[model samples]
Structures are given as structure tokens and as C-alpha cells.
Target: MTLPQALQYLGTAVFAVSAVLAAGRKGLDLLGVLVIALITATGGGTVRDLLLDRTPFWFTDTGYVVTILLSGCATVVLLRWRHPSERVLQIADALGLALFSISGARIAEAAGLPGLIVVVLATITGTFGGVLRDVMCNDIPLLLRPGTIYGTAVIAGATLYVLLQSVGVPRDTAAYAGMVVIAGLRLAAIARNISLPALTIRDTDAD
Candidate 1:
């Protein structure tokens, strides 16, 4: 398979596994695990596709469904056998976000959308799934959380990818570079505890 296609499968699996682990933290049953896994694996892509007016890929791509199911079950088994560090899940999520962002940008570029739309699509693809996952689990969505740099990383990487592609850089090379941009930015933020400054609204006297 081509690099992008391979990343798609691997990213989907990683997301599915991460969702399974998250459900375990909630003491969910088997069905609950599967639901979370499927939602996390497919949510972003569905939104991206809908916004792009394209068919949702998971419906047409059987591999995505299979990977989600197998990865979910396998993750449960692995966690039961031995606990893995939370870092593993974080790294997996980073990789997934990187892959999805680039892929989403490519789709928008191919669809002849404006560069701004491309960036928006990429951010949605990278983050919307995790947002849904967190909401379903009754946790603060990562996109709303401080210190994550989640959507910013995706936007930065996607804008770079679109610019590179616009200048006739190769698709694969641009995509690879885009992934690095996101993963590097996100991991660095996590390591350094960096985040955008929070905004507070205060009432002022009308004097």
C-alpha cells in the first residue's frame, strides 16, 4: 500500500485501541467498548466527509471497519494481560491526529476547496473524533482543554501541507512532512506543558 493508505489503516487501529483503553477506565462492558472504539475510529472522518460533500470513507472501505473491530478486541486483551503506560495512548493519538490531518487536507485540496477550507477540514479530521470520545466518556474534550495544543498543531501542519502541495511538492513528501509538523508540535507541547493562555471575562463597572 502507499504510505498514506498504510497510515490510514494504522492510524485507525491506534485510535480504536486508544478508545478501548479509555472505555476500560470507565468500567464499560464489551458492547460499550466496541461503541466507543467505532466512534473514535470513524467520527472525524465522517464529519470531514460530510463537510466536503463526499461519501464517508469508512462506508466504502471495509478495511477501516475490520481494523477498528480487531484493534478494539486486541487492545482489551493487551490491557488485561498487562498495563501499558498512558504515554503509549498519547503517542498513538498523536500519530492518528497527524495522519488524519494530512489526509483531510489532501481531500479538500483535491476537491478544489480554498486553502482556508483545507485547513479547517484538516483540523476537524484530527480533533473531532477525540472530542466525541471525551464527551461520550463524560470528560472534558481535549479541544476545550488547556495545555493540549491539539487543534493548533493540526492547523499548523495542514496549512504547511497545503502550501507545500500548492507549490507542486510531491503529495507523499508533503504529507510525510505534515505529519512530522503535527507530531513534533504536539509532543513538544506535552513534554513542556505548554498551552495557549486562557481567556477570562470580567465585569467592569459602568462608571
Candidate 2:
């Protein structure tokens, strides 16, 4: 597989695993977990393709579906036998977000979109799957939550990818660099408990 394809598979696997874990946390059955995993693995890419007027990649490539299925099944089996730590899931999720964001930007650029549009599309492609998964599970979407740095990491990666490409860097190298930056930043944020400032509500004085 090419670098972009490889990154896509990696991202899909990571998201599938995360979806299985999330579903399991809610006491979902195997079928429910598998369904969520599949959706989480491909929902963003499907949306991206639809918006770009292209056929969904997963629908065209059976390997993508197979990869997610295997990953989700393996995750369920592993979790059933031995529970994985939350840290492991978090790290995997960060890496997946980085890979998806970089690949999304590259795909948008290849489709001849402007840099700003590429970044926005890339962010959507990176995070929307998780958003859907969260909503399905009745939790606040990570992208919209105060404690989550998910969407911020995606935006950073997409912006960096666009900048590097504009500067004439090779596409693969630029994408890889952007992915590394995003994953690193996400991991750091998790480790240090970095969070956006919370909205504060103030009581009005008597008028």
C-alpha cells in the first residue's frame, strides 16, 4: 500500500478499536460493538467523500471493511479476556486522529481544493466519526467537550499539512510530519492534563 493508504488503514484500525471499547463500556453486545466500530472507522471518510463528490473509499475497497471488522473483533476479544488500560486507548486515539487528519488534508489537496478548505475538510474527516460514535452512545461529542483536545489536534495537523504542502514539501513527507506533530501534541496534552479554558457563568448584580 502507498503511504496514504497505509495511514488510512492504521487510522481505521485505531478507531475501530476505540469504538469497540466505547461500546463495551456501555454494555453493548458483540453486534452492537461491531456496528459502532464500523461506523466510527468509516463515518468521517464517508462524509468527506460525499462532500467532495467522490465515491466512498471504504465502499470501493473491501480491505477497509475487513480491516475494521478484524480490528473490532480483536478488540472485543482482548477486552473480554483482559481489560486494556484507559491510557492505551487514549494514545491509540491520538495516533488515529493524527493519521486521519494528515491523510484527509492530502486527499483534499489532491482534489484541488484551496488550503483553507483543505484544512476544514481535513478536520471534519478526522473528528466527525468520533462525534457520531459519541452521539450514538449518548455521550457528549469529544470535539464539543471542554476536556477534550481532539478537534484542536486535528485542526493543528490539518493546518500544518497545508502549510508544508504550500511550501513545496513532498506530499508524503509533509503528511508524515504533520501526523507526528499532531500525535505528539495530543499525547502531551493528555499527559499534562491540558484543556481549553472553561466558560464561566456570572451572576448578574441587581439592576
Please list the residue runs of candidate 2 whose C-alpha ends up more than 4 Å from where it truly belongs after superposition. Answer: 201-207
TM-score of 2: 0.91
lDDT of 1 by residue, 1-207 (tens): 887689889999999988898888899999899999999989998998988788899888799999999989988888777987878778878988898888888888889989998899899888888889999999998888877798989989998898898899998898889999999899888888899998886869786
Whose lDDT is greatest here? 1
- Measured with C-alpha atoms, the lDDT of residue 25 in candidate 2 is 89
Q: Report the lDDT tens digits of candidate 2 across residue range 49-126.
A: 999999998877899899999988888778758988889888988988888877778788889999999999888888
The CA lDDT of each predicted structure is: 0.89, 0.86
User: Candidate 2, overall lDDT?
Assistant: 0.86
